[model samples]
Target: MFAGAGSNLSQQFNLPFWVGTFGCAMLTILVSFMDFKKITRVLGIFTPIIIVMIFIICAYTFVGKTYDYEALDTVAQTIKSPMPNVFLAVINYYSLCAISAVSMAFVLGGSVVRIGVAEKGGLVGGTVIGLIITCATVTLFANIDNVKDADIPMLQIVKNISPVFSFVYSLTIFALIFNTAFSLFYAFAKRFAGRNKKKLRTVLCISVTIGFCLSFCGFKNLVALMYPILGYIGMLLLAVLLITWIKEKKNILAENLIRKKMIHLAVKKYDEDLDYTKKDKALFHRLGEKSVVDTEEIKSEIKNFVKETGTENLKPSEPESQSQSSDSANN
Candidate 1:
């Protein structure tokens, strides 16, 4: 899956090295949504065995070679003969770097999830980080000449250390690869199933077969070409995310301002209406006091009419009658 996709991406992007890496990553994500439980089970059982095999092969090959044997001797000589502590140191260093990388990835994943960008950012960040670490480690420590010539530098490193260490290292590598492959396979399966069940089986078989064929090209060369391209793609995605977030923030701010203005207008209108009603009531009471008909009596009549008829009755058009009564009183 990785190789075919990587090659395709490389050709498409005109970046044979990094684009291919990005393609492999995309393929992995595409596969992760499939049968997770089954994939996990397979990986759990297969990883250790693969690692052991890798370690043994690497160890035997490196140790059997006269140059590598001399290289180990040279390393030993440089370090003033092999010490038990040296082996421990090497293991500790490997363990530290591996653990740190995994821990950082988890932290980054959690952060992206918190920011609501888990689907977009988390995958990109994780892939870029993974590629960076892989490439850096291979370039830095893996014997340059041997790495180019040999199938696996890590296996050689293991062989240089000891058969047991080599086995352990191989196991670790196998586990990592298995986990990655399974994740990709599962994603692809899930995606295919959701889209079309009838075609799912066919898609899975073809994808896996293609990926397996690509894997034979060896892991190191693939990583060398794929990592940088992925990093660049990741940067582009990050820029897009930032722009989107900014736009969303602006929209939210505008909406909030509109909401606030609406609320203020509603409250102001309500207050004005309340004041108007109060003034009208006071005027009504004053007019009632000066009139022949009591205000309370008029109100009682209106209420009674409303109760009987199930409708509001006016107090009667008394404006003209009140004016005439006042004039007559004046005369």
Candidate 2:
């Protein structure tokens, strides 16, 4: 999207940026609902090829066009002035917010997986945290007036701190872009894999190649073309996600209630008898109702209990009893 924005802004506030950004954003969301592992593997294989293509294009563009520092300065000056149309400014601002929010949602999704927090509260909390971080970062660094002229506004700020820091910042940016591209490729591959490794490879290679080719029309021009488009698409997706969440709230709550009840019932069953049949134990195991359980310790105790008392006589025990059994077994 940033690439698209840069592209569009370079071309005189045209439609291309909006189109590209929104299109890519929609594609990202569509790809995300897919199986991730397959997508990732395919991306892993295709990324090097894509990068090579992008490098070639960059080389070509750098040689073909004169560096337009003066034009860049003019653009910066134009953006510094008040936007002629108040409505357009409002729309642009809202679009920026939507893009930020959607990006936050993706970050939240990744963090939840990493931290093993898949609950509703976890999703909400992660999203909130992501938004806070994004907003704070933008507030700290985004100088709207100078943003128009800067090739890489955020990176420029880092350079001001130190050249070494700027170089590191550039590395980070490269890593992030590569990571996101690979992740996107992986997502697409998973969705379309269908047990055909050859087909998956082909599709991923093609997509990355296309993206790489597109990237070299000039990064800033591409970004200018993409961001507004993405912003609009993000706004739509946000509405849908919000509506779905609202509609499912009651059902989600009810499911959690059922899970809590099942946990309570399993704990009760453990109290009723010192010995439980394998089937009875399996019932509690299948319930897997652990909003907060020390699963590692539980697994260790279960393993020892199976080895010592045998699986046939294994019983669900209270948390304290479970701890005691584990300690005794270890001793």
Query: Which structure among the candidates has the greatest TM-score?
Result: 2
lDDT of 1 by residue, 1-331 (tens): 3553444333333455445444455445544545644555565575445534544444454464545555644544443212246565444444444333343344333322113344455466556545555544533233544443343444554455565665555445534544565454544554557546546656665776676666657455655555444444555555675798687886545433332222222222234332224433444344434433355654343334334433212121357435533532342
| lDDT (C-alpha) at residue 89 in model 2 | 51
Candidate 2 residues lying further than 4 Å off, grouped into runs, are 1-77, 80-116, 119-147, 194-200, 254-331
Each model's TM-score, in the order given? 0.36, 0.49
- CA error at residue 189 for candidate 2, angstroms: 2.7
Q: Model 2 Cα displacement at 302 (Å)?
A: 15
Candidate 2 lDDT over 1-331, as tens digits, reads: 3354333333332345444434444455455455655545544454444344334333433454554566655544556323446476556545655555454345334323112235565566556545544443342233334444565555444444566644544544443444465455654654577447667666766675566457656675555666567656766776887899899887656545434333333443444544445654554454333423344443343344345544334334468456644542342
Q: Worst 10-residue stretch by lDDT in candidate 2?
A: 107-116
- Scored by CA lDDT, what does every candidate get? 0.45, 0.48
